[model samples]
Target chain A: MTPDPHRAHVPAVVHLDHVTRRFGDVVALDDVSLAVGPGELVGLLGPNGAGKSTLLSLVAGLRRPDAGTVRLLGGDPRDPRSRTGLGVTPQETGLPATLRVQEVVDFVGGHFPDPVPTPELLDQLGLGELARRQTGALSGGQKRRLAVALALVGRPRVLLLDEPTTGLDVGARQALWDAIREYHGAGGTVLLTSHYLEEVQALAERVVVVDRGAVRADDTLDAVLRRVSLRRVVLTAVEDLAGRPGVVRAEGAGDGTPARQTLYTPDADALVRDLVTTGVEFHDLEIRGASLEEAFAEMVAPEGAAR
Target chain B: MTAPTTAPTTPPATAPPLPAARLAWLHLRYQVLETVRVPIAVLGNLLFPALAMFFFVVPQREVAGDPVVATTAVAGLALFAVCSASLFTYGLGVAEDRQLPFDPFVRSLPVGAAPQLLARIGTGAAFAVLGVLPLVAIGAFLTEASVTLVRLVAGVGTLVLASVPFVLLGMAVGYSLSAKAALPVVQVLLFPLAFAGGLFLPPQLFPAWLDAVSQATPTRAARDLLVQALTGEPGSAWAWPVLTGWIALLAVLAVVAYRRDEGRRFR
Candidate 1:
């Protein structure tokens, strides 16, 4: 396939080529290859231990892949210079308890060539009111906000956040999402990992679902959402519904007073038409699109069942 | 949706990379600030050696009255100070840091590890020097520990040089173990080393076999060198070589431990 001319000039902000990482004998990442172009906001969605953190760690230069290459900002991720324009907040960050919030921001900022001023960065994160407070004194949500503030202090062109809002309350999560949106709106590339499907749905233009150390799907948010758009048809039926046309699976009582059955299908309308044509008596029909949670579960189900 | 798409808010004017020395200094400043905020830690590090002097040497009239003996005794305590600071600062401190998530964040920064390590050494040295002051005052006041300006300067220099092995050893322990294990390990290692090295009693009082074995340890070499610098008394022929050997060995061990820890934790 020819490279699209319009995209040829913009190098990928992150490139992982058949990368594999292992801890002892356990594979944390299995030959995962991904490329995120500049200005793309990609969400890495996965359950715990599904290699989300491992991927971010590789990009952040905190760990090396056992095989293949990881390039950040067009250079080897392991090099300090390669990470100079990158920022990361790991899943959990403990700030120095004795240092005031502002001092921590300044200290981290000092390492960058051009850093956002501490006050302005803190203000953006809604942490200005607590800038002078010792980090240990702040609530968990506040600490999380401060950690994110530190990540942005360098005015990084690419940001990698691993479960950035894991401990945050709803209000705090919203605020952090707003801040992240503003950054992405300003053309910053963001690759964030999250177990919260809603968070990813709200922020990511592209979604990569990872399961069992591999990417199950990587596409635009709408594409991924559509991939899991299967409908559930619930009804009471006297007939054996398992082999019905268009039904992926059906489970419930085949015979009972108002016999209950739930059939899963890619096309609920076609399945309903088939039931009608076959003259299968049914009642209490309900058809609904799968929730993102169900889509995520269905996506990761094979790995779960294999284990 | 057509927001003015000006060139992505240009980053603030890029400042030149801070010099390594300046970065190291900033780390030193923060390290000192963090430690000092806990007054008890500072007091504990400073008071132990001084208290040891007050109880051990001041009451021994014959030893205190003799300039050479008193100077050597004070020098031994000073060596003890440096050893304690090195052991606790790097040993316990490093292990504690390893448990904190903040450490990984700092380690991942673009500035590399040089500044952090140098800052650690600087902080340890500062504390070591500070911890010795009370012992020095006690020696000068309660005993006849007389030394020329040159001897005093050389003595201080010797104390710092002697701390290298202990500092590296502390780092080795810290990086290889958890905070809970490291604390007890440092405690277990420190006292035995101090006692065998003649910090508590003179090497002349050691049994023949004990004295022979003591000469092989870094602590003993440090104590011997400190006494030599303070009293102008010659140390054993093996002192410098033994110290150098221990420094080399500990340096290798420290590097291995650090790399192993990094591999295990970050990887």
Candidate 2:
């Protein structure tokens, strides 16, 4: 169950307006405001201590925000009806380790109106074989898979997952991605926070960058990436000549040794032409666009440029 | 089968909506089963007092009052129930729940907090009862300690009432300590309380100062109440009042601690 009361709603489903949560002198969430629509899958991205978990708790209706009102589905979070529409899988391992997979699924399913059948849910997550096995016997990846299945059994209108894949292997991570895609395909809204930049880029359509308990950027992945021009361009010879339009800085082996230079440029075509004119026989020439990772890093970077 | 053309009996009297009362009952039932399934709790509740009676009272055929033997056994078993349910099981279980992210899961469920609280209290009481029954049977059959129906019922009532304070105390302990730490604290408290209360050994057998300490312990008051109820003998005029006071004090402390812990300030 979520420890926050602000996260139980429908249209404008989750509202955290000027919410501030302080633990003694240290403020965990400082006047944070964010919202999710009925069927939007929003990815919350931040580094450690970025208030990602705190924000999720605020929306999940667990913790009461100190300075703000969080209305979920047009009702108070403590309202029983409002809770019926919400499902949460917190970062902490919530399942009883002694219980078998099927038992946990059944237990959680019993709380909802029309839950997915336990066997069917297990089969969907590729966990049918492990249904009778104790949760303690599962690997980290398997436990995560089971957690995802637990969240979905409720047929919830809004789903909250906190670091859903914190300890998953590469293959298991993609498996979870497929599951998330299927969930969105069914028009279910999802709110998630993850440290995995690639996972965020691949799964979330809209990204919200939080740092020091505040939203630094709330935009689409493309829009946020356009905010900064940190592209990696690998070129042979590249340039001894520097005057290229849109090129901020260029450095390379002007002497010899494959003559490669990295160009920090917004324009790739013009730089390529300048390289051609310089008559520095380019071998491996490729222009890489700015990834979400760099955009996220730039957004959350402190005054000292720390990620 | 008579194919009688019956009037449309209003869709065969559609079943009434599942009552909230039924949900509460089912939740309590589930909690009871889960609590009772713990083997150590069950063993301590049933076997501990039986063992105490076998070792302590059974060997001494003639004591100051052979009838006091039955009172001693009932008091021992009653205290055992309290230690198992209120201190050991309740404290450990609450710690486990706190560690889970269940606050979010359950907070989002349609279940009321009242039902959860009710289920916990009910489970603790039920486990205490299970612990007391075996000792009652053992005293009757093996020791040949005779207790009338009314006396037995009164003893059972006293045992249950005596457990209220312990249950509340257990709740406070549960909220105060993490699961790993709660178990050891429960064990440490159990022996001193059981011994101090004069449940296993009589107060006369203890040192003069220890007997004074026994008079203040909840276990002592509870034991006195059970002993009076069983033997039909009153020790002191203050016994009943002191026992009742202990129950009230423990109840207040338990609820206050629970309300504070449930506020989620620490989390």
Candidate 3:
């Protein structure tokens, strides 16, 4: 049978209506339902063994689900058309280590019709000079870049990236974020799994937090953090008060040496002003709120905390 | 000094479409290229057989004056050569491919399982060509036998057909064993099958039960056909039907093993 010729124009790229997967007694995915529309970059964030990889495999047609349905661009997971519409970057760098970088990319490119040109892909990922180098010769960060490049070469409508920045440096990580933004800007959809909460906050407009094989929180980054009500505020101490109420711990100048004391409190301005009135002087005082890391930690802490 | 970074350039907004056939053709070519990329496999599949023929079969012929026995020896070696190249090269290659993530990509592509299997068989047939060509040339030039063009063509055809059991045997071996154990398993089976099939000695020297057991061997049946075609001896006609049956049997085994393993991968 021939594939549908008009799938390239569809807007909603991936729709997992109610997909559930079980490995023997363990439920890898529990009645998970999600949708990724065109021009969207959704982050699937969870700790190890939280079934992030299994979810991607189901969408990529690597493994079948035990119950429910997963539809990619209006076709079943195993459909040839569905597969062609999607590209995947697995956590493990899956390239043949012995092959030249160019050859490995070329080989994977051969699997898809109308793949991006080799030079274009090389230049985009800054791998132009390493084309002739064997994959085994690449550094850990370079290997991860090649893995990302392999997935992008297909110009797929929906991209599934599992820990795309696992071993990358800061610059490399931002460059990947820019590339992902560019893809999204051009109307491609992406579903990524990452342990870096900062990365998810920076790149993904929507996030899904799965814990114990179920969706613990699924909403915008701001919304989920708000749902968990986890907050943090750092204060620069102005007073040398030996004892204080409502302060968890104070660091920096309890003995009156010349260092700033940081106090953790739910109330920020009240404690700072009280210390100032009681013969405390302060400079460069700053208050910080809860980070995504703290919020996520609180959300999944009941499942024995995310390592 | 700091490294200078270049600005990223995207492909122009529009490029032409790539036809579907081009993709499938490239996949097949890449698969075959990677299958034979190893130097050890190349030497084992091509060089080892030629070396065995030179040391074991050719030297004996130089000492013995009987042309008939030498011709039978060449026929048996040809059969063993086909088995070695197909079972060793194609079998182990499939096992290695299974360990890779290639199956996910293969399933993702527009190509079906049938086309992939056909590509593997084509690769096996290519290795067969590399392993068998030298023997055919040397046997025709150095030996006294029925080396007519028709007979030579038929001999090559029988040798290629004899690869069925080997290819099927490879699929089973490839599926049942890990990559590390595959080569050793192939090594243990190769000599036994070759010896039982009369590649090392003529079937006449064996006892009655051994001869009957040899008659059941696919290599023995195939070697007999090659010997009959080469030496103009029509006495071993029973070997033809028996070899064809073994070919069919091995083909069934290959398909079963492949399907079972493939199902496991999907499940």
Candidate 4:
């Protein structure tokens, strides 16, 4: 049951067909297939060791799959020629320790036929001031920013960013997202992976949730979120309401008058109606749509799906 | 994904990458920059041979006062300098870089490993030559080693040629072992090779049986050739064959080690 089965017809910049990869007896990727069409910003959402990095390695030609073929820009990924237009920021940042920031940028850019000018690229990534500083002297966040800048320096047609902002603070993460958005704005194809569901929810037009080395759900962001029907209802009330109508699960604060409670249900509308009609006096009632957290959980653990 | 506003376009046929030689030169330039910034690392290669020359050769009148003896000793130590520099520079230097995340990213670049690898060789050679300068200065200034201009140039060329097999050997070790293990291995190999090759002790001092055995080793063969280049006297006929044999053998081992490393990391 593959999503976008006709994806091959569109001439994908990156395409993997039934690829399987293993380490010793451990299967890293199992019969997985996917494609990224030109100019699409696809988010690969998965938890740690879900084979997200493994998939990128296959496309980047750093590793070969035990089965099936992978193509980059219509050429075999292993061929250096095929990778000329691709830029990648792997999960770990590794700039030469003694090389200055600008030198690192210049060195990487030199490999490409048409590269972004060093000064402009550094300034865009907020690294202009650090150009003369050695990479080893930079803070962790600064090194990460430089890594992303190196990925962009080559003016590549495709960018593959693995866990691009996993450990970044909110502000840093947002800034990187904006940089990615700018690239997307210019029609650069991006295939980024993240374990943070909110990261996918924030930037991805399409979400591909990967778990246990297989595709769990691959669809438009709205469509994936729509699968989540369990709305959250929070209120403070005097009565016990664990088994209220339309509520599938409920938790309450330790026994107290006017205790706080949260109810999860399929229909907040009917639940609110039942609460009012039943003469339950509750204050501070709040209703919100189902979170991507629960939606992702359902996708990964199908039998427990609320819908 | 936000549906594209402009039409989706496939990447054009890839442009011709930077010329391979130019890329290799650029790689060498940065590699040199990286090494130059670390003064101590370069100093290690330079100081050891110079210290040996100063303490052992300069103080010994019989070895340093006689022209032929002094010149051969200088040549042998120069070869030792090249050998030591090649081993540690490639063996430990490569192993250390392997520990860094940057090494793999460089390996993944589209220009392929040739440019980077060639540049590493150039960097190692540059520093190996730098390592020799102090020893040369100490021998020239403090001792009576003398050579014609032709022989002087020949000795330099021979020293570079003699470094090849050791560089290959270092690469094999570098690729095959982690940094922690590689350091001890390179040290253990370096000291013994230098001693057995008669680089420290004169070949004539070696017992006949030991001298024969020494001639078979790359280090001894390299030392003998270096001595011949400087003294204009021929060494045992085994020099070229022994050196050539080690070069061929280590060359294969180096290639095997490189491929094995690639397979282990990427496959």
**Of the candidates shown, which would achieve the greatest lDDT relative to the real structure?**
1
Candidate 3: C-alpha RMSD after superposition: 8.9
What are the models' TM-scores? 0.87, 0.75, 0.75, 0.84
Each candidate's fnat, listed in order, reads: 0.27, 0.23, 0.18, 0.33
Regions of model 2 farther than 4 Å from truth: A1-11, A76-81, A90-93, A169-171, A232-292, A303-307, B1-41, B62-65, B100-112, B180-221, B228-267
Error of 2 at B214 (Å): 7.7
TM-score of candidate 4 relative to the true fold: 0.84
DockQ of all models, two decimals each: 0.32, 0.19, 0.18, 0.27
Question: Per-residue lDDT for A1-307 in model 2, tens only?
Answer: 1122234543476767788988677788888887777667788889998999878766666666678878666566655556666677744366666667897777667766567878888887889999999777888888888888777777766778888888778899888888877776566678889887777778888788888888887878666556554665667663353455666555564764556666656677777787678665777778887665764565576644422
Off by over 4 Å in 4: A1-5, A90-93, A228-291, A301-307, B1-11, B205-213, B262-267
Error (Å) of candidate 2 at residue B12 is 29
Worst 10 residues of 2 chain A by lDDT: A1-10
Chain A TM-scores of all predicted models:
0.84, 0.76, 0.75, 0.79
Query: Sorted by DockQ, highest first, which candidate order results?
Result: 1, 4, 2, 3
**Which structure is stronger by lDDT: 1 or 2?**
1
Interface RMSD of each: 5.0, 12.4, 6.8, 5.0
CAPRI quality band, candidate 3 = incorrect
User: For model 4, how does the per-residue alpha-carbon lDDT over A1-307 read when each residue is reduced to its tens digit?
Assistant: 1246466466888888999998888788889988888778899988788899889878887777889899988888776788787888733456777889999989988887777778888887788899999888998788878888878777777888888887888898888898888788788888999988788878888888788889887888777666555788889998878778877667674365888887877789999999999898899999987676764565576343434
Candidate that scores best on TM-score: 1
Docking class of 2: incorrect
